[model samples]
Target: MMYQEYVDAITPDQEAGLKRTNGRMLANTILQNPDCFSTSDRASAQTILDSINSGVQQDAVDQLHDDIEECVEDATDEYSWSNC
Candidate 1:
């Protein structure tokens, strides 16, 4: 199967796992750095949050694009146009 197909097959499951992992990471960070949520730690927290959010958004977009490609491929295959 193509890489895109693999991504399309795995994305939804991966997303759930990713969310759990992110939740654990946040919990650990809070436990390790109790002050990290304070006004004094705003900069650090903001940086971490931004990075996590960006990564999640990118993953979601990539997965969506992969799924769309797979759907198009399936449609083409149904019509026997998949020569690639």
Candidate 2:
């Protein structure tokens, strides 16, 4: 089975699983079928996996920034009490 064929064969459930793992599952899948995937195919998969990891990392960083901003705003509001 070619790499593209493997990708095309993924079911909706498998796709959801892939998304949930940030594409990490693809490494196992490719490893299990080493005889089927060529060097270029493996390289392509690695590229895709790297891209997924990069996106996930960016999302985490963005969320952290948003959380910190919210915390700072709350702290500022608390300290700005007119009674003080």
Candidate 3:
């Protein structure tokens, strides 16, 4: 479901016993979800999101991944995660 994407993404596996959504997963989500970002933002966002997903070969991308992960982890709840 549309909602499950976020729920799965936000909950850290550290506590939920679920797989924490890593950069790769987040990248996949970005690639797969058309509505997650604005049309103007999607192209650039996907590039960075995908870059981080790939084991963060680039330090900048890695930092970006960390930032995004932190933001999501801090901001999300079940309902929001549910509808990512």
Candidate 4:
């Protein structure tokens, strides 16, 4: 199959490199032509680049924070110290 041959051609590392390159190119396009995307899309794209530069994706960080908060809340609720 054409798809199978295509898939077999590139190694995992090569695929990852290609994906990163494509993402950078897309980000550059978004920055150079803001009109192509909606306001939220533009903001999201910039946030992605910011997260990449900072060494982690913003969404993953936010989700981690949220998960931690929920865990803390649950633990506190499980050991309530009620006073009269």
Candidate 5:
């Protein structure tokens, strides 16, 4: 999402961290609704990503990364790997 866009313009290490965080969020969302990941019912997921990409600002990429980390933490109760 926003985190992914921000991650895209960062260094490899940071990018890897962001990817991991994104994967965690995606996994959790999928866990809540598997169809969102493996079926044709991914409209909501796409919309979230679209919003993130469209509204994300270069100055906010770092903040977006932190936001994703928070999201992952809220989803999994763990912020270690989620803090991209």
Candidate 6:
């Protein structure tokens, strides 16, 4: 089956799991639903999911770092320090 078919076949439970895991559940779903996904498809999905998850994590960390820096800068600045 194509990737879109596999995606469309995902059950409500799997959808919830995907939301909870930030899509990390995709690899596990591919493994569990072997009837829907071929071995090569599973491998490709896992690789893609890993790359996406890694990028998401890095983006989150970058945002947190930026927020922290902004907060610190605000706290140190004489005009904004009081509000911070």
Which candidate leads the pack in lDDT? 2
Off by over 4 Å in 1: 1-41, 81-84
Q: Give the TM-scores of the predictions, in the order they appear.
A: 0.50, 0.65, 0.29, 0.41, 0.26, 0.53
Candidate 5 per-residue lDDT, tens place, 1-84, comes to: 543453354456566446545644653454466643555435655664555454455437888899999898787765554766
Clash statistics: count for each candidate: 0, 0, 3, 0, 0, 0
Model 3 lDDT on a 0 to 1 scale: 0.56
On lDDT, the stronger of 1 and 6 is 6
Task: State which candidate, 5 or 6, has the greater lDDT.
Answer: 6
Report, for every candidate in turn, its global Cα lDDT versus the true structure.
0.61, 0.70, 0.56, 0.62, 0.56, 0.69
**What is the lDDT for 77 in model 4?**
83
Between candidates 4 and 5, the lDDT winner = 4
Which sections of candidate 4 miss by over 4 Å? Answer: 1-15, 56-84
Candidate 3 stretches with Cα past 4 Å from truth are: 1-21, 53-84
Worst 10 residues of 2 by lDDT: 15-24
Worst-scoring 10-residue span by lDDT in model 1: 1-10
Tell me each candidate's RMSD, in Å, in order. 12.7, 4.2, 18.5, 10.5, 17.2, 6.3
Better of 2 and 3 by TM-score: 2
Q: Candidate 1's residue-wise lDDT over 1-84, tens digit each?
A: 332343344444577656545544554454456654565455554565676677779989999999999999999888796565
Q: Name the regions of candidate 6 deviating beyond 4 angstroms.
A: 1-29, 79-84
Candidate 2 lDDT by residue in tens digits, 7-77? 56656766544563635566556756778778886787787678777887888999999999999999999
Residue 82, candidate 5: C-alpha displacement in angstroms: 45
Q: Residues 16-84, candidate 3: write the lDDT tens digits.
A: 222324433554555677777566556754775665445434656878999999888777754576755
